[model samples]
Target chain A: MNRRSLVTIVSVSALTLTGCGQAGQGDVDNGDGPAEITMWTHSAGNPGELEVYEQIIADFNASQDDYQVVTEAFPQGAYNDAIVAAAAANDLPCLLDMDGPIVPNWAWAGYVQPLGLDPAITDSLLPTAVGIYQDEVYSAGYWDAALAIFARQSVLDDNGIRIPTVDEPWSLDEFDEALSTLQDAGYDTPLDIGAEDAGEWWSYAYSPMLQSAGGDLIDRDTMLTAEGALNGPEAVDFFTWFAGAFEQGWASDSGTIGNEEFNSDEVALSYTGVWNAMDSLDAVGDDLLILPPPDFGTGPAIGGGSWQWGISSTCSSPDGARAYLEFSFADEYITEFADNQVVIPATEGAAEASEHFSSDGDLRPFVELSQRFAVLRPETPAYPVISSTFEKAAKDIMNGADVGSTLDGAVAEIDTNIESNDGYGF
Target chain B: MTTDSLTERVVLRRRKVWSYTAMSALAVIFLFPLVFMVVSSLKPDSQILADIGSPQAFLPVGDISLDNYFGVFDRVPFGRFLFNSVLITVLTVGFGLIVNSMAGFALSRMRWRGRSLVLSLVIATLIVPFETVAVPMVYWVSKLPTLVMEGGMVKYDFGWLNSYHVQIVPFIANAFAIFLFTQYFSTIPKSLDEAARIDGANWFTIYRRIVAPLAGPAFATVAILTFLPAWNQYLWPLMVVQQESLRPVMVGMQYFFQLNTAWGEVMAYTSLITLPILIVFLSFQRAFVSSVAASGVKG
Candidate 1:
């Protein structure tokens, strides 16, 4: 090689090496200039929810000189993997949002830390909205979603099936009778149970049915085994009826994932979440009814919780992140999210001011349903595996496999996984 | 006409009809998805779901409009994502062809002590998936040094995160591309190199003049193959590229998958992004076919 070329290469390498500095959330927060606080959200495609967040960020940044919160949005479907990858690179943002049921797993994995907020702030929020892992509040959200049986009053009156209320939801036999009556009344599929959807929707939608049947995902007292709770007699009863619904032609496992069948007058009843309520109301108008789910021996139950915000353990400006979150929980912002996303506001004050979820509002039934029947998913780090296993077993039962054996297999899988992870730090 | 001749013509006509009929059926089998995607893109979500179980899914019948195509822009910055994808894809393919071909030339024409071992190592890397190394690559790239312009001043920055180069750099010099070039270049006789050497041309000149021009089919094949994965990149960019401006088109697909997915918008976005690839494939159809046949026949 030539001497001139060698000298030039050496000089460039030295200059590049000299440029190396530690990469993190900008500069250290040492009472210097406003520290850059990075925040992430799984709200990229959700314009209604994301707009509220962006407004809160803009207001917060303008109100403070000690901190500047910069936000990035990711699609909900791919957000979890992005956070995991960022954590692996030791590059997690200062603040990020996660689905509510996943909080315990992320907490146990050391991906997030407690918010260190006062109890007074959280006490006013909905019980199901806060994510408490190991007695510390790791995350919280502005709203929680509730599920209901959407039906038309005219269809029920025509079929001679009584309308179900939150206080007087249908019993197991009554629900069966109603489905049969609707099917006989010329509805091809009487119910849209959303069985065609994949992944977390399975456990979220069906586990509540099991809970109402007197079965739990795990014993909440010890939070360890799925043995008796998952495969016991109560769970068996629920699975049998679940399978029978398809065989008796009351429901079909073949429909679009959302409110299509119900809106098209093909199904007389739709068991869906609040997000689908607007479309059903538009389709059925004044005849639309939002009825509670059936009570199978126990009271009615619906899945609780939605996306919640939290702080990462590796955050360089933890205080700044906490400040942003605290500033964002005002009642007006909460109401804005509720009105925009068509969800139940997490606080009573927010609900009172909300357009759809308020008193004398069109969608107030969801609030009553959430308060009366909402049940949070099992809070354990083993929930990830448990949820997946339950989905597979439930799907197998729906497809005509033996219900007892499927539940037994699911119990064994969950128990073995918990034992392998040492009870997931119990 | 004689009876035998007339019978022979009848058989020929029947054979021709059967051939065209079979070809049309196969074409429909392949083209059905593209047709459905385009037709569905023109319908509302309710209409799209309603037509799904019938032949109406393949037709733009009732309630057809360009609303979804326009809605895609409101949801996503389609132009920005397209530009990002094009920039990343073009840089990766252009750099990949140059670097891999040079490596192929060195391994094929030049004498070296561990040439075969290096070629074997490059081929072995083809078996290892990119997902396995993604985390380590993200960590290393974050620590890599780069120059950035801030407020009209050139400053040294430490991380490659939230940058375009990170998306472009890590994907260049693919192992499959390198192995392909090596195999393709080996088929070019070394006698060209020897003759160029006797004529006072350097190895690089010999590669540029004699070898590379002859490997046009291989280059086109590599360009097409590399162009695909680079354009369709999702996970790596999702991991490393934090800024929305640097994200590619595949990542934009996730934007339509909210709680209640915008099915019409998804189809519209897909149609827009798939247009470039279909154009690339059509434009290079012959070279792609020739390169695949050439590689397979040689093997």
Candidate 2:
């Protein structure tokens, strides 16, 4: 090789080494002066949700110079796993958002610290918006999502079905009659009960129906077992009805979990979240009717909780993280989040400020439904195991397995997992 | 023409036509998915679902626009992600070829103690799944020393949780690549190495001048093999790299799968990422095919 070429190679190698050597230095936290507190969110592609968070971060950054909160967003599907990996590496950020039900598990695992905020800030928020575990607040959410029965008034009127109101929801017999009438009127499947969804939705959406039927995910009094709670007589009856829906062709697990089927006139009703209300409103206009879930034996119920923010236990600057968390709770930001994400605001003031969630708005019914009937899932660290077990058992029952045996198997699995984890700190 | 000659000619013609027809049908079947993806990318979500039951799904006939492509760009940092994937993939492929080939050369050609044991151990690692070792690997990488420039001064730090090197360095020394290289190198005659050494060439010289040049198929096979896993990495990158700018195309796929999935945008993003890989494979089609046919390596 020529001398000039060799010199060129050495120089280029040196420069490349220097560039890589200077690429990434961990941002240190000295507990003083513009601490770069990092935050993570599960909102990578949801532009409407992410835009509100970005504005909040920008405002908080510009408000003061003591701390600068920078955020990273991950897609929701991978967010929990990412957090767990980061925690394993001991590389977790100062602040992060978690699903409501997971806050307990994370707290019990020492991934998150107890969020210490003023009562004035938290007292105004809805109970479901506050993630409390072991009687200590671990996270708080700006918005809460509610489940409702999405229907078209025209379809109900054509089928001679009475329009159910929040004060007096359809009784168990009336609900069955409505489903029968809708099916007899030519709707292929009268209801889309989100049977197609798996994982957490099984416990979140259908367990609420079980609660209304006088059975619970676990005995909340002890928080240690699922034997009697999950496989009791009422629970068996609820599962029987759940399976009969599929057998009788009132609901099917074949369709996509969206408002498309209901909007396209393939189903007369949809049991879905507030996230679908915007599309339903756009498609059905004034004919849309957001009714409460049907009343079983106990009362009408729906699942509660959504994404919430928390401070990591390893955060060096706890006060700075608290400042950002506190700043994010303002009514205006909450209203903006609700307006953008089409969810219920956490506070009445924020609800009043939201365009779609206000008193006279078309989606206002979701707020009342969330207020009256939303039930948080089992708050124990064993909740994840319980959830997956219930999902499997429910799916089996829906597909023709004997309800009694399925429920017994689910209870056995839950009991075994809880015992294996030593009751998961119950 | 004689009657027998005419019959034989006609029979050959009919056989050739039948073969061509079969080939065309197989080609269409293979191309169906690609055609569906490209066509679906131009349509809306509702129309995409609605057309699935009909022949219109395979045709670009309804509610077609560039809206989904635009939505993809708006939703993700497409350029940044693609750049990261290209940078990481190229570096891994380049460094992997050199490292694995040298290791293969030593194992196959060099006479040393514990050589057989070392090759066996290297092959043993192939059975250990990546997911099994991923957690420990993450922990070790987070504690490994790293050089970084801070405040215009060079310094040392630990933890490689979110950088380009974190994604590239862990994947470069692949066991399967080394095994393929060693098997390929063992097939070459040792006489060439002896001849090169008689001319006063050293081990490195023999490796560079004699062995590497004649192992083109192995090199091509290793390059393509390394390029794919490096490009399509999802879980490891999702676990180690938190920065969006450093994410790969596979990890970017999760961005489109939120509660209400944007099906069209997903097809568009997939179509975008698949095009580059398709081009690379097509460019190296001959060598790749020959190498696979010889080595019997299945990806």
User: What tens-digit string does per-residue lDDT give for candidate 2 at A99-184?
Assistant: 99999999989999999988788788988999989999999999999999999998899889999998999999999999999999
Clash counts for all predictions: 0, 1
Cα lDDT tens digits for candidate 1, A225-295: 99889999999999999999999888888899899899988998998999998888898899999999999
Instruction: Return the top candidate by TM-score.
Output: 2
Between which residue pairs do clashes occur in model 2? A22-B149
**What is the per-residue lDDT of model 1 for residues B39-109, given as tens digits with 9 covering 90 to 100?**
99999999999998899999999999999999999888889999989978987897788778888888888
Clashing pairs for model 1 are none
By DockQ thresholds, what CAPRI class is model 2? medium
TM-score, chain B, predicted structure 2:
0.96
